[model samples]
Target: MKSYSTRAMALIASAGLLAVAACSAGSGTSSGSSPGADQSLSIGLVAEPASLDFTTTDGAAIPQALLGNVYNGLVKQDDSGKIGPDLAKSWTVSPDRKTYTFELVDNAKFTNGAAFTAADAVFSINRVKTAWTTSLKAAMDVVAEAKAVSPTQLQVTLTKPSNGWLFRMTTRVGAMFSQTGVDKLATEPVGTGPYKLGTWKRGDSIVLQRNDAYWGSKPFFNQVTLKYFKDPTALNNALLTGTINVVGTVQAPEALSQFTNNDKYQVIEGTTNGEVVLSFNNSRPVFKDVAVRQAIRQAIDHKALLDTCFAGRGKLIGSMVPPTDPWYEDLTSVAPFDLAKAKAALASAGVAGTALRLRLPTLPYATSCGQVVKSQLEQAGLKVTIDQLEFPAAWLTSVFKNADYDMSIIGHVEPRDLGAVFNAKYYTRYDDPTLQALLASADAGDEAAQTEDMKKAARRLSEQAAADWLFLLPNLMVADKNVTGLPANAITESFDLSRLARS
Candidate 1:
């Protein structure tokens, strides 16, 4: 659920105390009235959600649009990537770290008029184990039991001590659902957050209306519109022409100069956990050979790819571990770009000139980056074919679900998504017991041990060329000067409309 198309546009925060980088020019005021005068605002984004039901859907788009704005979890991750209380007013963990007791807020109510209670928490957690179909549901497998000790108190016991279980709760897997509103999740979503579904025009936009009866402080905007655009030009045009007040994700990084030269817009540049990966299907006969994988990794010039595809606006991380993760390491040197070494590796594997498919989602970054990957691989004597699949629908079904791809390009935007994407059963089909063991050890170890072990796991993964990490996508946004509370770092899947306010 943390993975999305590169254009999905959600960024993440770092662990501990992470500083957010943001800058703007001109007066921070839109072409509207003063503070609290404009009660509605329109924002532009790419890659709209396939559906509203995240329990059955897999991509990050749903959670990016709905998580913090519509649904409230037991715990929420702040912009700093620190976990804090949300619906659960407070919580206590046992000394053993296997049990968690939560005291729920007494005043929270769902959009459907159902009062939120500990029983709803029980139902939601159990539903993840029983009915959720997404791969992200595996995060809840560690839970031994979820019980409502009282109407406003909930308890959950994990099967073992896990350093990541509580953190994962800050994701979509921890979203609380109402029993009464379960029937129409795909069409209508009801939650205890500050906003409710207003109107959704499929392929165009979704409007979220403020919940007058929300338990938390009311958000500044009475209504927020999330307008979708497949074409990056249209996305920018919407902001330039006043169709939207904000370009939530500047899809065309090269076009930023148009806004940067103008005094009406503020450009925010920050960091995100979104790693644009060149993933290989390990189950495929060609990729099953580690030598071939290594050759592929060594063939591409990451610096050149980043420059051509993203206007050199991102970082070359060389591994799945983004800088925000505590276990991060700069492993780009592990597989230096060497055409001669690449050819030698392919020849040793008896796969030189082997034909391979490079399927790509229609997301802006993938389509752009795939060309460079193909041209580079071909230079190393591999025959590469490019196939563009419609994003979220065709790409999610063919590549992400069925593993019907030799290789693909995607942006894994979820914070700390190493364990999920590399799972044996995941679409990558990367079944390595040693890697799995290291990840397990990292999760069960103490904070210091976890960091050390995770570093080893990441190094092992990169050394083996498990996947080619293209680069870390930068968080870039262009909004009207008046839009305040814009997060400098995208630390979670949610765009968090509640955080936005007019200056």
Candidate 2:
């Protein structure tokens, strides 16, 4: 979970204007094409990227739209979360596991017309440490050196053996950038992928056009439009009225019946790494007490909360690790919902009537879940207040950067983001030396030891009640019947457009 900065623009209220624009832009019809051979596609999404550049902007929306669509990485994670070759055709690890050598693809070229070579790979890897401003850049800090041995070969050596380094390369940190195109990354991007940025209408939509000179297999659609919607009903309506082909992120799960019952549409229900967390600001005096934190965790019934807030569409993951991770465990028994235990813990801490704030980002899940949390905690004899802050901007400022809230809720969507959220200086302000040591040990170990250590770290976080793991967000998507190659699970930040096709 990288720090979501205030840079992401707010969603403007002009649904009617967008409806007209989308109908013309996303008709999925191309000149001289037959009925079933649509050359364009439109997808409804909740969030829009504030900027095209993920190097400076800290949010998932940017990469979700660009990564694997407009940009290609050295490596990429598939639907199952396995690392596979992208620009780099193949790779090998040294016996020591500290160095990685890559075999580059010669035919690939950046959208800017620069050849994708080892030098560009080295430059991209090195730029992350020297120039990237987002917290995700730290993943590249392990690189001791990235050198190009030849036009088709690249080598990267780490300071130490890291099991997670190569996997992290599948993320935005690994996106290959052209040296000549670094000037306008925020407004214009250059990458070697199947699609190129076509048009971006702020507060409306971003259209990606197919690169006719693409190196690999041709994408199914010539154009893909990511249409933005502030309200979930609008997103659903966009699909119903034939304005869009797919709803990429289903915001309102309770209204899913409208799509599920229709034969013309297909509803995809899968899992994501998004853990809708009930975050407690551990730095605050009232939450600093372990008993208070545990009391809150014990008070809320996770199942009921999930049922009420999310329409019981997600998983009850008791820790930061989602089931997709290798080290996942069902730790729900750790702090089961118990009203008596919650009251007893609050009384023991002498903070029964202490006033606490549950500040929430204006995300659908947080707003819906905040009510349940307030009701449950109030029953446990704790005074609670709910504050709805505008997402990305106000929420990131007051809750994430300033640490001005007692409690908050936001979905941590980045893959395998346990280390980022629990970081000592992160918004949660949970600084446990033992947990840090465990994470460090996990990163520097072999595959077997890494999984064991990560499991231990997750267990430690759950037992200590670092934060209440509310529920893992379900990857609920609604697409037209003709849309093929839809990913069942969302294991990465990118809503990869390369695999989608029309039947």
| Top of the candidates by lDDT | 1
Best by TM-score: 1
Prediction 1 TM-score vs. true: 0.94
Give lDDT tens digits, candidate 2, residues 408-460. 77777777888877866777889899999999999998889999999999999
My TM-score estimates for the predictions, one after another, are 0.94, 0.92
Measured on C-alpha atoms, candidate 2 has an lDDT of 0.79
Report the Cα RMSD per candidate: 4.0, 5.3
Candidate 2 residues lying further than 4 Å off, grouped into runs, are 1-38
* Candidate 1, run of 10 with poorest lDDT: 10-19
lDDT for model 1: 0.81
Residue 231 displacement in candidate 2 (angstroms): 0.9
